[model samples]
Target chain A: MIEFKNVTKTFGKTTALDHICLSIPKGKIIGILGPNGSGKSTLLKMVVGLNKANSGSLSIDGKNPSQETRNSISYLPEIDYLYSWMTIQQAADFVKSFYRDWDEAKYKELLSFLELKPSMVIKKISKGMRAKAKLLLSFSRNADLILLDEPLSGIDILTRDRIIETIIKDYRAGDQTILITTHEIREIEGILDEVFFIRNGKVALNGDVETLREEHGASLIEIMKEVYSNENSQW
Target chain B: MKIANGSMLSTLYKKDIMSMKLENIIMLVGILLGHLYFAYKASTGWHPGTIPFTSSTIFSIVLFVILLGTFSSIRREWNNNTIYLIMSLPVGGKTIFLSKLLTILTQLVVFGGLSVLLGILSSLHFLGSDLLVEGLGFISKYQLIQELLKFVTLLFIGVIQIIFVAFFSSIVGSLFKRFSGFITFAIFVISNVIIGRIYTEMLKLFMHLHIESTRQSISSEFFLAQVGLMLVISIIFFFLTSAVYDKKVEL
Candidate 1:
């Protein structure tokens, strides 16, 4: 449901995405795997219309990303984006007012599943809980596309497992498309239908996990090491 | 299940206002204490002249708060990374801009209205109603109402113009990755200068065209025409700034 044609984004002298082109199909769980500064987050941000591509075109579902497209794209950025003064419930209500796809039942279910109290203030909550809160808000919406940028980064292993479980439990295969970016491959490798290994703002390798394993005769993590080692570029 | 556009706008307006609740309360308390202290002083046989001076100072403080709030409201989003949430919303840039503008205008009206009322009441209490009425006796009540309306219109237009300038400068500043604060301050100063010059020229043009030989001072028609000109400029800036915000500003 997302297409990037020769998209290149540069911040000052450093290029974030370099003339990269890729197509992400609808209703599939896709993992965009890369190390830090590998343009994974940049690619996701471009899809969500937060970062504009400098040269090439990017579109979702045959339409350009804009305010209207944002309705269908639920994004969980790698930052604390919620207001500090708001409780999780207040933030949910504020977000719910803007989206028609908001599922109250799903929200409450995720709240309990995530072990997040509705009355917990965002500022007072721990980082892992805040990440869970962000995930809750995102998953609450029945958006056609969900972009999770570094959701597992800096999160504890337990919280990360819970987050991964949250994704797997609520995710409806063939109904919602999820594009997640992270270097933490082993944890998410099992859930991903397809994986794209990005390096230095370019796609180094991508394919279906099963097909890739069959062809390479190795696990995704071993394959990741092979890919990075074969490339001369510094990580 | 989606809300209509009007409701969305109202929801955004409410959120903006809610965000400022703490600042509003602090301002309210400050104004209240100022009034009470002055009231206490007035009752203790203090000089009458200090009442008007102190009341005007309070009004100035309110104006200062409005101007500062106009800039900080937008900055707060960036400081807290909440702009990510705001930009991700389904609403366009115009809605975001207008909601903020509406919130500031609402505060201006509410706080400004209170200040004017209290100022007049305190003036009356200190100076007595007879003297105040005598001062106002020179003009008919209709003329007085007309003048009051004109003043309010001018004040509103002026404040709106400043808000647009501040918004434009802030947006322009965001275009750069470094030294954005200096850039924003510089743009603000330059924009105010250019706008102030244009405003002065426009006022002069209107006054010259509308002035009559029989008139000793500037006519009310000139003020109305100037207010109209300012309003049009503010609207143009509003649209331009909103367009930039929509297509250009990157989060």
Candidate 2:
């Protein structure tokens, strides 16, 4: 479980997150929906301890997201994380040595499933392959929580479905929590149990995905469009 | 369960070595080849005079290798955004810093040991030649060993100094983010100029103070003491770098 208590993060004069409070429970797929600059990335970064909140506190499993907390969490940033010079096998070896809970069998299976060559340098891989590599690394970890920022962002529809299916298959029931952030609402709608819509640096709506869809009499995509339009109407 | 700190440290040290990509082996081979070439050249009438084949060359090569190894190790991690992965590990920042320092020291020691062995072999090869027999008689092996030991120690300290400077530059670059490359270049140029000017001024001051004494009056002990002081300063800088790196926010 993760909790953010009255968290506020500011960059110069602009506020990235403003006095937001949220509690995320375990064993659920949570989707963070927001437009560009809606502070989705900032919130996730704070939860992972990459970015410090200007004023409040964030805790994962009752401990602050320090190095110790990080051990229990896997994070996949939108940007490429694999080193340009490291081959896939070398990267795997390096990462495996660092984590005590590293599952070598799972890692090898994921590599094969992703069709990644062991000796291939990450820089030479296509973007889709790189994304798969990142996914493999994150999913292979026996972590209690996983934070994936825009995992489906530049992939084709079929690849996106494959990625989603991979994640669903690998999901460790009742032991792992996953928080995915993206603007592509429909792509992940069926997979997400809970949805949080962020607007103007605050959580505008947060609830069960099915409940919200039924209440609004629309799909997640239509609801998101309506929410963004409503927020912009005030501006 | 409480983890034994020693095992954790050893694990981190091993990881750091692997991350360095066998830099130590490459340096050892490079140093051996360089010294062997120089030794062969000196013995084959390439240079008629006695070659300055001292332990200092070995120490210099080891120091250079360590400097390059440490810089590339840390710099590559930062450039590749691997610092996030490293910092996010279960280890504390202090442990990470100590592991890096240990890795750098171990690399330098390995390279230094290899260079010494190669240097001795090269010296023996040179001494076997008839042309160098006459010159070799004048050099005292005991004195050479002592001087070499002192120079090796000094080189170790110098490598530490270079590591501190590189670490400082990395922290600065990380802070500046987008302009870090340009800032690091400018800092490199300016720092060299500043150091050169300071060295000249210090030499001038020392000369003025000892105007009455002859050059012969100044002993090797004086130079050794100066190097010792530099080693102490380098240690302080190393600690400073570790402190900054531990607390500084990653951009």
Candidate 3:
């Protein structure tokens, strides 16, 4: 379980997260839905311990975000983070050295399923293939928590579908928690168990996907539109 | 299977070393070629002064490389966006820091030793075997060996001190969100100034204590004391740098 109590993060004069309080239960797929600059990435970065909170506290599995918590969390940033000189196989081996929960068999399966050869250099691969490579490294770990930031961004439609499929295929239901932040909501709407709608660094709305759908009497796309429309009108 | 801590450190060392593979190769080839060119000149003309002058110039270039590399190593991670991967790793900051420091030390030993060897060979070629022996005729062989040992020890400490200061300054600079390069430069200059002041004080104290001793014994004692003090100071900088790296750096 991950808990945030009055957590606020700021960069210069811009507030990234505003006194936010939320608890993410274990073993669920949660979508942190927000447009660019709405603090979606900052929230994910906070959970992964990449960014620090200015106030309040954050805990992962009852422990504060630190080196110990990092062992249980696998994070895939929105940008390309892999070393360009490393091939897919070398990257995997490098990650495996630092993570005890790395699963070699799962890594191999994902490699073939994603159609990425181990010998393919990261620098030489296409952007779509690089996205798959990132997914391969993240899913290969049996981490308690997996955070994917903008996984679908810049990816081709076919590759995006494959990435979503790979997420579903590799996910261990009821044993792992996954948090994903992305703008391509329609493609991943079917897989999210819960969704948090953030606006201007605040949690505008959050609830179970099915419950939110029923209460709003519309699909997530419609709800998203209505929520943003209301904010725009108010402004 | 779980990787032991030793295995993890080894992996880190290998990765860091591999990052500098091209730089190391270039350094090696460049130094060798430079030595060969100088050796050829010495063979033709036999200028006694040229070998020492060239060797010192080579030393200056190597020192410049070390200084430049200390900053570039840290900056490259940010430029490539690989800091994200490195920062997310489960290892502690000290481990990350130790691997990089070990890589630089390895380079220093390998290239420094090679240059020293080549310099000695060139000296022999220019001075000839009998002249080299006669040049050291005043001192006993044991005393000459002792003096060489002292010089090497002092060189090692001095280089480590400089590297530590640069490393510490770079890590401190990384903690900021703006103008990190300027900040690092400022910190480097300020810290060196502070250390230089303290070293001067220590030097005065050593001179006062060894005033009654013979010049040879006094200098020997002073050199040993300087090495001991620098080692302690370097260790302090290591801890300070690693602490910042572990707790403060953000990507």
The most accurate candidate by TM-score is 1
Instruction: Identify the candidate with maximal DockQ.
Output: 1
Q: Which prediction has the highest lDDT against the true structure? A: 1
- Can you write out model 1's per-residue Cα lDDT over B1-251, one digit (the tens) per residue? 44577777887888899899998998888888888899899889889768888899998999899888988898888989999998888888788888999999898888877887788889998889997778778556435666667777787788899898888888878888798878988998998888889877876776577664233333666776678778888988888888888889887
lDDT of each: 0.87, 0.74, 0.85
Candidate 2: list runs displaced more than 4 Å.
Answer: A12-14, A108-112, A115-121, A230-235, B1-45, B50-69, B110-151, B178-239
TM-score of 1: 0.95
- For candidate 2, lDDT tens digit of each residue in A120-140? 888898888888878887877
**Cand. 1 Cα-lDDT:** 0.87
Q: Can you list the residue pairs that collide in candidate 2?
A: none
Model 2: how far is B109 from its true place, Å? Answer: 4.0
Q: Write the per-residue lDDT of candidate 2 for residues B1-251, one digit (tens) a residue.
A: 22456677886787678777667667767786787667767867765233345545666867766766666677777778877767656666567767887888787667777777666566556555664564555445434545556666776666666666666665556666578766755665665466457556656766676633343333464556557566666666566666666556654
Displacement of the residue B133 alpha carbon in candidate 1, Å: 1.8
Lowest-scoring 10 consecutive residues by lDDT in candidate 1 chain A?
A226-235
Question: For candidate 3, lDDT tens digit of each residue in B1-251?
Answer: 34577777888888888877888888899889988888778778868668978976886687678678877777778889988998888877778777878888888888877887787777777767786677677456436667778777877887788788888888888878689899999999998899889889988886677644355543666777788888988888888888888777777
Residues A35-84 of candidate 3 have per-residue lDDT tens digits of 78889899988887788999999998888888888888899999999998
